[model samples]
Target: MSILNSFLIKTSSVKKICISFFASQFTLLIMMLYTFPIINSQIGTRAFDLQNLGYSLSTANQIVNNLNNQTTELYLFPQLTLLDVFYPFLLALFLSSLLFRLGKLIGKDNKITSLLLYLPLLAMAFDYFENICIILMISKSIEISKSFVLLSSTFTVLKSLLTTFSWIVILIYTIKWVRLKIMKKATKSSLSQS
Candidate 1:
């Protein structure tokens, strides 16, 4: 295999696969580099909030509200294309990859695989809730109020750090186990040939 292929194999575990699926879910918690130069330049020239933008803040914060006011601004990103639309789904995919690794270690059987696949889907639903809160925070549709800035920044940073740590520790070990199994299978074949 080439370098990239080898890299992918080393990282490929059922858990990692599931995490990748979940991480792509951003529709609920949509914010970008929140401070990226691209964002600053793009959303920077203007600001908006639900009220001025002609939307109501969720009282029950129901799923219907989430769907109704997915975007805080009417003209937020005329240039923003389909990739932006699927970004959340893609993010959920990435996060779900980790669950695949978790399942492998817990049990790589058919039962475990089924469970792993479903776990991330559940997580995606929860993430949508978080996104709802984020949508409510865009002040003047410009910047979020301090509370939301703190909520999202703190929640996202902590979640990311935990995810990274889990991948480094658990996923690395799981990958090693898989390699060992493959090597063992190879060894058995060689012995039978002899």
Candidate 2:
């Protein structure tokens, strides 16, 4: 926890946050516009990573079977191992930095805010685990276990939930921060006029 706090503090500069955010966005765009479309076209369906609500074991098997039938695991595996691997880390960094900045702006840079900063990291970890599970399922499609499928689905759902919650928290803090900035400007204007 101390290490996490220290790291967040060290990297929460506005410039780092903006860079991470844009990089994450660029990675996402590449995934959405190129990688995902190619894999989806080959498999004739959306990939497992996109299934935010989670998929059943049977569905997992079906998707894997589709990839097997299409022989497109080559395409999917590289995206998961390369771009998807980097994307979660970038997103986590961006969200954590933004949240840290917002906490400081709203004068709430205490233990709670520090703890809240872990949400993105947790989501990223889940996403990584989900990717690993997916890789395993793809490689072992003929003999994929129900337990592995269940675990992967669980990780997917957790990642989705945590990411959504982190965004909501960011949105709330942004509103408060904007309000504070406006109030400060109004106060300054009134004092200057007087």
Candidate 3:
């Protein structure tokens, strides 16, 4: 926890935050515009990771079964190894940095804020675990356990919830920060006029 707090505080600069935000956006654009479409078209449905509401074991089996040679190849290589790997990490960094900065601006940089900053990181970790479960499911040698499927679905649900909650927190802090800046400006203007 101390390590995480130190890392967050160290990386919460405007420059790092902006870079991570744009990089995450660019990666998402690539996934949405290119990778996801191809994979979905090949599989004839949304990928497991995209199933924000989570998937049942039967649905998971169905999706895995639908993976043709090309789709499986794509999913294993670029989808899981490259795009998904980077997207979660970059997004977590951006969100965590932004939240830390916003908390500082609003003068709420305390224990609660520190804990809230963990949301994105937790989401990212869950996403990685979900991907590992997916890889295991995709492998021919490995017997797909009902437990693994359940765990994957659980991780997916958690990732979605944490990510959503983090964004909501960021939005709330952003509104407060904007209001604070405006009030400061208004006070300055009144003093200048007087």
Candidate 4:
């Protein structure tokens, strides 16, 4: 926690934090454009939210059952998983960092704000676990492991839940931060006029 605090302290500026946010977001956008569409096209409606994926082994098997053999094979393909691996990492880094920075800007000096920055990382960890489970399930398309599928689904749910929570926090802080900045600017302008 202290190490995280130190790291955040080092990056405790709008410019650095915003840059991190943009770079990660940009990378994510590119991945979605290049990788997600292919995944989506192959899986079709099975491309539900990550949370849905984590429902249970029965649900996971059902999703697999729904896909045609070609689509199923494509899902298990090493090439796609390679691309998939990076998405969660980028999302966790950028979005979490963005929330952390925004919280600092809005809440300033609030210890809870600093702690809240870690939630994104938690989501990222779950994402990684989910990816690993998915990869395993895909790789062994014939003899699917129920445990792996179940665990993967659980991780997906965790990732989704944590990410959503972080977004809510970020949204709240962002509004506050914007209002504060506007008020400060207005006050400065009035003073200059006087």
Assess every candidate by TM-score: 0.42, 0.91, 0.93, 0.74
Off by over 4 Å in 1: 1-37, 42-85, 94-130, 139-146, 162-170
> What TM-score should be assigned to candidate 2?
0.91
Question: What does each candidate score in C-alpha RMSD?
Answer: 11.7, 1.9, 1.6, 3.5
Q: For model 2, how does the per-residue alpha-carbon lDDT over 1-194 read when each residue is reduced to its tens digit?
A: 48877788888898888899999999999889987887777667778889999988788778777775345555545588889999999999999989988999999889888889999999999999998888777777446777778889999999999999999999999999999999999999999999
Query: For model 1, how does the per-residue alpha-carbon lDDT over 104-156 read when each residue is reduced to its tens digit?
Result: 55455355354444443443443343344444554233344455544544433
Q: Sorted on lDDT, highest at the top, how do the candidates line up?
A: 3, 2, 4, 1
Which tens-of-lDDT digit does each residue in 1-194 have in candidate 4?
Answer: 57876776666577776676676677667655654566566655444333453566665666666666666555555334654566566666666567666766776646787667778889878877776666556556445667666667778788888888988887888889989999999999999999
Model 2: weakest 10-residue lDDT segment is 68-77
RMSD of 4: 3.5
- Model 4 Cα shift for residue 84 (angstroms): 3.2
Model 4 clash pairs are 54-153
Candidate 2 lDDT (Cα, 0 to 1) = 0.86
For candidate 3, lDDT tens digit of each residue in 52-76?
8888878777887888888788888
Q: How close is candidate 4 to the true structure, as a TM-score?
A: 0.74
Query: Weakest 10 consecutive residues, lDDT, candidate 3?
Result: 138-147
Candidate with the greatest TM-score versus the true structure: 3
Q: Could you tell me which 10 consecutive residues in candidate 1 have the lowest summed lDDT?
A: 47-56
